[model samples]
Target: MAVVNKNQLLDFLENRVEGHLQEAIRVFQNERAEILLQPAPDGGWSIAQCLEHLNGYGKFYLPQINKGLNQANRSSNSEIFKGSWLGTYFTRMMEPTTGTKKYKAFKNHIPAPDLDAPAVVAEFIHQQEELIVYLKQARQENVDAIKIPLSISKWVKLKLGDVFQFLIAHNERHLLQAKRNLKNLEVADKS
Candidate 1:
């Protein structure tokens, strides 16, 4: 990850996350519930499932980030965040440019077939707003030093900077997936 001032990082993250929220809202306004829930022809997830999956991750990460920020010492604040090697690798893996290396959702993150599309969309928007708050809080602390546990394994931890980067990148990945699912639905409808 490139070294940037805290404000720049916050702006970049907020723009990326908010773009996802806005795109989802736009889809909700134009699309019916059935359309959002329609599975891809490839047997992949639907838009609602994609949003719910992101919500599952937010449910774990948002609170953990808040708790970590609350308990962390405030003696130091670095203007530039030097991301961890492991965190950077993980974040990069989640990027859409990394090709289609899919990972399993660990059961709990998987949304049911009967998921409510509107509710899932609302939850994702709420979570993105919460992430913005956490980013603000992070600006006041030594984000590079604070550690947040990975959802895959509690034993594995990452720097706060890396965690934010990974989460944002992951959000972008799934939001793109949701958009693609919607497009697939459109194409299938034509046939």
Candidate 2:
């Protein structure tokens, strides 16, 4: 992982979360339930399912992040953030870009076919709001010193900064997937 200014990293993440929140409010929230529920042309998850899968991750991560933040006592004068190799690898894999390989969602994280679209969207918005607040709080502590446990294993942990990076990247990946699903549905409707 590359070394970066801690504040700069947090600021960048905060902006991303803000963008996601705005998109949810401006776009996803206004989408009809049927449209949101409509599955992708490839038979993948629907838009609502994508959001719900993200929500499942948020439920696991947000509380863990809060706990880590509260327990952290180390304060660093230097703003530099050095992510662990593992952290970097995880964040990079989760980032959504053209040609990123698809991965199956964990069985626990997979969302049900039947979901209340409005409520799912609302929950996602709320989680993003909470994430923004956590990012702000992280500035007061040494991100490298605080370790948050992974959802998959309690024994394995990542630095606070890495957790933020990974979680945000995961969110971005799923949000893009949801938008793609919506676009495919629209195209299908026209056809």
Measured with C-alpha atoms, the lDDT of residue 159 in candidate 2 is: 94
Across 27-73, the per-residue lDDT of candidate 1 in tens digits comes to 75356788888887799988888888888899999999999999888
lDDT of each: 0.84, 0.92
Q: For residues 14-47, what per-residue lDDT tens digits would candidate 2 score against the true structure?
A: 9999999999999899999999999888999999
**How close to the true structure is residue 25 of candidate 1, measured as C-alpha lDDT?**
72
Give the root-mean-square deviation of each candidate in angstroms.
1.7, 1.3
Q: Would you give me the overall lDDT of model 2?
A: 0.92
- Residue 44 Cα positional deviation in candidate 1, in Å, after optimal superposition: 0.7
